[model samples]
Target: MTLIVDQSTINIQVLFMVNKETKKALIEKGAEIIYLKGFNNTGINEILEAASVPKGSFYYYFKNKEDFGIQLIDHFLVRFLSGADRRLSVTKSSYIERLRVFFDDFLEFFKGNGFKGGCPIANFSLEMSDLNENIRKRLDTAFDQMNNKIALFLEGAVKNGELPEDLDTGLVSNFILNSWEGALLRIKLTRDVYPMKLFYNFVFQDLLNFN
Candidate 1:
């Protein structure tokens, strides 16, 4: 009888793989902490304790809190952009209907959070823009990219004859994004969703109904 052992299989088994779940926990916990405590006020030990991740692991993944913050901003953009792209993409619903649905859903999300944390990008802008140039630059780029996404959809609406051909898509998109961010701040202050609901009503009811 001859017995053969596969050395490659053993080596592969011994190789350590990064724990994706642990890394994700760190990011998610860190984000929540930042929401509760402003970024500058948030301590590294708080995040580590909340995530149950070791200090070495955090340093291995991030150079420092600033690096981690950049990543968090990136994470927020990815999630927000994906939802925006869906609502603004071509669909059977009219452009106005799509806009209504989008804002309504956003209002519902804010309500779910009890109007505690406002937009993450907006929060970062208020907190870190003056203090950290790198973060401020990243935030500026992110806001510009988000504005572009809105402009792209508005352009599509113009092509589909849903909006006026001469309408300034760029300016309109900028106004809409800025208005929403302001509304979010008011919602946090009042602990009410009426401000957001009012924004939706104004935008879709009066602003977009130029026919």
Candidate 2:
């Protein structure tokens, strides 16, 4: 099996690698600025500067700020879910325990950040939903994906006998996500974890009926 690769193919592969790194850098830096300043408040120049990309090449990488915003949402989801996947999948315990730890992990993440930059998805949802339909729809998909992930965790709990088979995981996951974002919003203003702590307690204790 002689797998002979061509020079043009090799060049294309190298270009893809370069472009991928550049794009990821833009999204990462853009996320940091947008998370703090907000989508409207953030400027493309600022993002390019933070990313160390040339000022004139923003269009080469993205159609415009709105396009960048969509990719930024994707990068945020991937980074967040990668961490969550580790916490949920790598452990040797029931999904119920893993799910609880997943929440706790994010709780600690917020506490460590001093409650700054509330949920990026929620922030973008509020800022862009009415202003741009395209961005709003992208944010909607991101939120749905999050809900689906939680629903999967709940389904796992049921399979493990930690939750009732008849439990409505879809409804429960949506509620849990809503409650979490609401708590995050409150925590951002309060600069305290009390709201999140309360949210956690109500979900795991009263709602989930965990002892």
Q: Which candidate is the best by TM-score?
A: 2
Candidate 2, residue 15: the lDDT equals 94
lDDT of each candidate versus the true structure: 0.84, 0.87
What residue runs in model 1 are displaced by over 4 Å at the alpha carbon? 1-20
For this target, which candidate reaches the highest lDDT against the unseen true structure?
A: 2
lDDT of 2: 0.87
Candidate 2 steric clashes: 0
Q: What's the lDDT for residue 163 in model 2?
A: 88
Candidate 1 has a TM-score of 0.87
Q: Lowest-lDDT window of 10 residues in candidate 1?
A: 12-21
TM-score of each: 0.87, 0.92
Candidate 1 lDDT at 199 equals 80
lDDT of model 2 at position 47 = 87
